[model samples]
Target: MTALVQTVSKSTLLSVVSAIVLGFGIITVAGHVQAATLHDAAHDVRHATGFPCH
Candidate 1:
């Protein structure tokens, strides 16, 4: 029981750490992007994901 708990705790902690790292990376990269470039990227992503941009 204790071993199972420890394993779950470790997995949860790893997931949280990974999410934080990815979020920080996105924020850092986004901060350096120009407004028009970011808008274009978002528009492309929306189209690729089948979201109606118009």
Candidate 2:
């Protein structure tokens, strides 16, 4: 009975950790996408307005 309880507890803990890790990964990817989009927009704006950043 104790072994069974331990197994269940371990499984639950692993599941929770996996979910948290997946959430963090998603957030990181979203942030990267947002940063890339902002960079592209800034590049386009500089070209359009003739503001050199070089």
Candidate 3:
């Protein structure tokens, strides 16, 4: 019997690391931001995009 092993390419590893860093940064910043501020930002974006948040 033979066992198969797989390895990650450099590009794939870099992409995964980048995504993890970006996600962590967004979460950390969001945690420190006030809920009302986030709501206002989202509300304004909704209006700008004509998504009808109201």
Candidate 4:
């Protein structure tokens, strides 16, 4: 932990920590969602990104 703090700038560390917290929160919320709802959301994202989900 000390080595990482010494090697990384404050902004970089802050960005990494923020991303980790956001990802964890998304996972936690998604776990409690209905399976059909999750699948629909993922399907919409895939289409939005021009990916072929079907």
Against the reference, the lDDT scores of all candidates come to 0.66, 0.62, 0.61, 0.70
Worst 10 residues of 4 by lDDT: 27-36
Candidates in order, TM-scores: namely: 0.44, 0.45, 0.48, 0.51
Query: Candidate 2, which ten residues in sequence have the lowest lDDT sum?
Result: 27-36
Error of 1 at 24 (Å): 0.2
Among all candidates shown, the one with the greatest lDDT: 4
Q: 1-54, model 2: which lDDT tens digit per residue?
A: 678657677779789789999998864444333465654656655556554432
Top-down TM-score ranking: 4, 3, 2, 1
Provide the clashing-pair count of each candidate structure: 0, 0, 0, 0
Which regions of candidate 3 fall more than 4 Å away from where they truly are?
1-6, 33-54
> Which candidate leads the pack in TM-score?
4
Q: In model 3, where is the ten-residue run with the lowest total lDDT?
A: 1-10
Q: Cα deviation in Å at residue 6, candidate 1?
A: 9.8
Candidate 1, residue 54: how far the Cα is off, in Å = 32
Off by over 4 Å in 2: 1-8, 32-54
The whole-model C-alpha lDDT of candidate 1 against the native structure comes to 0.66
- lDDT by residue (tens digit), candidate 3, 1-54: 122213766788789889999998875444434467665666655556554343
TM-score of 3: 0.48
